[model samples]
Structure formats: C-alpha cells, structure tokens
Target: MTANSQMVTIKGTRDGLTLRLNDQCSFDSILEELYDKLSVNGVDDGQPMIRVTIQLGKRYLTMDQKEMLKRIIREKQKLVVEHIESDVITKEEAFAWKENSEITPIVRTIRSGQLIEVKGDLLLLGDVNPGGKVIATGNIFIIGHLRGIAHAGFDGNEEAVISASYMKPNQLRIAGQLSRAPDQDAEGVYIECGFIDKQDDAIRISPLQDVLKQKPDLVSFERRMLNG
Candidate 1:
C-alpha cells in the first residue's frame, strides 16, 4: 500500500520517468514522493539517473517552488544544476539586462535629445520624441511610434534590424548603414524601416501598408551588473 499523504502516479519509460500529480496534492507531497521513488532506484543499473518530469497543474509556481526543485536536482547530482526558466525575464525587465546580449529591448519611452546607448538589442514600448537618440550594439525595437533617431548594431552587427509601430523618424542607422526619412508621405498613418538584402542598404522608413512584421527570433538580453 502507498503512503496516505498524497496521490502521485509514476510511469517509468525507456528515456526516463514521468511523474503526474493531482491538483489537490501540494507540491511538498509530490517532492516527498519523488525523493522516495528515486531513493529506491539509484543511478546504477548500467543505467543513468532517471530524468524526472513533474507535471504541475495550471497553477503558476512561485520562486520558492522553483528553488526547491533546483535543490532536489543538485542533491541527486553533485555537479552544478541549472534551471531552464531561471533566465526567462519579461519584456519590461529585459531592457535593463540586454546590454550584453546579441539583442535587447528597452521597452520605455525616450525624451527628446536623450542619448541612450545599449550594448545589445534595444526595445521601447512608448514613443521616442524628436532629438532623442537610441544607440545599440545589436537590434532595436520601438513598439510605439518613433520620431527620434535610432541606431542599431553599433558594434557592426550587419544583420541587426530596427522596428517601430509608427516608423517615421528623422534619421535611422544600422551598423554603418544610414538613411533619412523621405519628404513625401510624412504622416499617412503607417511607418516602418529596416535593412533589406541587395543594394538596398538604405534605412527604408515608410508607412507600413500591410500588417506589422513580427519578430520571433529575438533573443533575451543579459545584464552586466547585478542588483539586489
């Protein structure tokens, strides 16, 4: 007979083991079950340690829960343990962290003549007023309207890109490439500009006639300094 604490189903597979827990069961109980189960099956069947996948319900786990899981893993394996979700930062928090990444997002508005420099990608959720400037070593993104100057890939990342909700700008620069906004079509309701292949290295800024392009390959930004 199983312990009367909580209900947990364990299924052994060729690859590893999967543990499914009921919503009614607390995570502590599930941890107890895991410790019990793994204790019986030590990593010595000419077989490696059984990889365990916990099935957490719809509830969002707290940091404490995540720490507990990490502790368990570290105990089983004497080596350093790393968790996948530990580095996942939201777009807002990411702005402070992206100076060292291949790409980063600022996610904040910039006032006029404000000189902002980033080592990686930059993202802004609000508008960038005239005279304000944004420079990055990587890509740049303005989710809202952009009226100031924006420079991306400052470190010579030619593949970098710059995007904005309303893409009208006084000037745009990417790597060594630069372009100015055209006289006509100054305000037709849409605007976008980015580097395209071929001889069109110009910063193409125009009203977006079609749906705004989506960027999925964007990577997370890392911080150079740590704050408590």
Candidate 2:
C-alpha cells in the first residue's frame, strides 16, 4: 500500500513476521526494500524471531521465482521462510524445501591474498592462512585453523555464526559488528565460535563446546587431520 520503491508492507503474524509485496513494484526492488526493512526492524535477543511468512496476494509466481525470493529473505535478512502464500506452492511443501536446502561449500585452503564469497552457508575445509579472507551470508564453518579474516552473515543478518576448529583469526565480523582475536597462546586455543550476544550489543567469542550446549546445530564442523 506504499509507493513503488517502498511497497512492501510488514506485519506481525502468529508464527512470525509477515510481508506483503506490492504487485505494481518490481520484485527486485521490493526484495531490496524488504532487506533494508528487516535490518532496521529489531529482533528480540535470545529468541528465534527471524521466521517469516510472505503473502503474495493474487500474484502468480513461478516456483523458481518463489524459491529465489525465499533465499533472498533467508540469507540477506537471516530469517527463515516458513510460508509463502502464493498461487503455486503449498505451505507444507515450502517448509520442507527450506529444511532440505543445501548449503554451499568451498573445499579448499584459503591461502594469502585469496578471497572467497558465498551466498548461503559456507564450509571451509582447510586453513585460512594470513592475508586470506572469507565472507558468507550465512554461517561460516572452518574445519581447520582460521588465522586470517572471516566474516559471517556478510549481509545485515545478525543471527549468523562463525566457528572454527582453531579460532585464531586476525579479524572476525558478523553482520555489522567487528572484533579482533585475543592474544592467546596457540596451545591454549580450542574449538571456538564468534557470535552476536543477546545480553549485550557486542560480538563475543567462547568455546565452541559451550556454544553447542545452547544451540547444538549452530556449528557442524567435521574435523580434518592437520599438520603442525
């Protein structure tokens, strides 16, 4: 019910937030505005508040287009697409697709000067040496050492996570918050994760095992044998 550029209407639903896109505006612009709005709209800390349902009243959307829309909202806004009340897809089917969504994986060592960017979740199979960098819109999992820079939730999504077997990164960023690694002896380091805390508006790091206690599915790192 707004102008062409900002035609996306947002409302709260019983399940989560619901959005209605203006048919007159192009989907691309509508989605961009959606991302901007979610970033501005605050989410209560320590709550699973990012699930969203989209209502495309009377609009005929193709399966591909619908999936693209869902992915955009999920990755850019760090929300889950629980439903899309459109002409084509069923509610049950949509939820199942989300569960079956496959994350993108980069199976290689990130050496100096190398940069990798991923749309959804990213899986790094090897070490991130000095001068290397990795950016992802979703969670970033490093099966080996992370000595360089790694940014999870490259977009404005705050619930993203960054975890590694040996978390010794030079710099770490999640969404908009940034922080540097502490000067700790390498031997003292263990599996660690970086995330935005609900209690405070700051980025914090803790033992990955401790993180797993609360959010078990947050990190899924399959350890790989490393050389000294």
Candidate 3:
C-alpha cells in the first residue's frame, strides 16, 4: 500500500493546517504519517489544541479508522480533533485515475483485509471473501462468488456495472450511491448483474443474461466506457 508515488502535501490556510494526502494512498499509511509528523514536535501539558483539517481524497474512512485517528491526535498528542474533510471525486485507480483504457484482473481470491482499486474494469477470476474489497472506476465482473464489498463506478460513471456468477456481496456501491446485501437468503439467485439506472438514479440488479441481452454490444467494456 505504500508506493513511491504516494505524495503527501501540507499547506497552511486561514481555515487551518491542511494535510493533503494523495487519494491513491491507503488510510493506514496516511494515519501512520500523521502520527509521525504531528507527534514529533508538539505536546505540552496536554494543551496545544492545534486546529487541523484532514482532507481525505476520494476515499471514505470507516468509523473505527476515524476513531483511531482522532484518538491518536486527541489523546496521544493533546490536539483537538477538528473537522475531517474528503474531496470525493469520481475515480479510477490513484495511478490510473485519469486514463480510461485498461482492464485489470485478479487471478486469485481476494482475502480478508485486501483492498483493490483500479482505473478501468476489473475481472475477478476467483471469489471475493467477506473482508476483501474491490473498487473500480468502470465495471466489475466476477467469475466466481462475490461475497465481499464491490464498488463500481468510483469515478462517477453512471454506465458502470457489476456482475458475478454468485452475487452475495456484503455491499455494492456505484458512483455515490450504496446498498448492502439483503438480510434474506440469496440461494435462489444464481447469477446476477448490477448496473446503474441513470433514469431512476439508482443501482439495479437483474439476471445476468437478461442484462446482457439488453446491451448486446457491451461485450467490449472499454468501448462502452468510452462511447456509452
């Protein structure tokens, strides 16, 4: 998750000190850096209360992660936890965020704690376990079971879709909208596809074959992303 390209920028403004983390970097890395940078020079009798505006680029932090970050600052360094901001953008991968020309594939199962982000379509050759996550700017096609978090259209592409042989994903997100698996059993649904319904402004799921038939020319996903 720590890449050489992960750029961190800091700036001071009237609002406060803004630590801008590259959207491509993982949350863990950002948090570690935050602790290292802020804790190095400050901390006087638990009373500095420096105002910090943390900006998350294109990613949402889990409640636990947020709490932990606040704890590190508020308790460890005695700094007041100020506003947390995120520049939520429609995205692809951090490195390939600007391009719309690639199709990424995973040859094996995405295990627990593994996170994947891609610029174009994603083809998973294996199952996605419960703790795994797949986020793409385009579409997601799962050859096996999809039992984890799958986010499509991270770049706000309304035409992006998600499909799987067995669609039991923990959660599904397209653009800014998100939905979770229903509480009921999914044994009856063998194959499924999820797509954004631009007219209704919602993500809809249907039988895979039926969805394909509706867009017979969609076999080439890159073409669709470019043309549709």
Q: Which tens-of-lDDT digit does each residue in 1-64 have in candidate 3?
A: 3555545555767755676777776778877777776667665785545677777777777669
lDDT of 2 by residue, 1-228 (tens): 335445788887666788887777677787778778767875556666477888887676778988888876766655788887865566786775453333666788999999998776787888999999999887888889999999997877788888888888989999999998878755754678898887887888888777777666553333221210
lDDT of each: 0.63, 0.78, 0.76
Report backbone clashes per prediction: 11, 0, 3
TM-score (all chains, Cα) for each model: 0.45, 0.54, 0.51
- List model 1 lDDT by residue over 1-228, tens digit each: 455444566566665555555556677776787677656655644654445665555434677876786577557643233322322455655864443464444666788868889776676778888888988877777778778898887777776777777776778887888876666654554446465334565556533333134333443222321220
How far residue 17's Cα lies from its native spot in candidate 1, in Å, is 48
TM-score ranking of the models: 2, 3, 1
Q: After superposition, how far is residue 111 of candidate 3 from its true place, in Å?
A: 1.5
Where is model 1 more than 4 Å wrong at Cα? 1-99, 102-107, 186-191, 206-228
User: Listing every candidate in turn, what is its Cα RMSD in Å to the true structure after a full C-alpha superposition?
Assistant: 11.6, 12.2, 13.9
Model 3 CA deviation exceeding 4 Å by range: 1-99, 222-228
Q: Is candidate 2 or candidate 3 better by lDDT?
A: 2
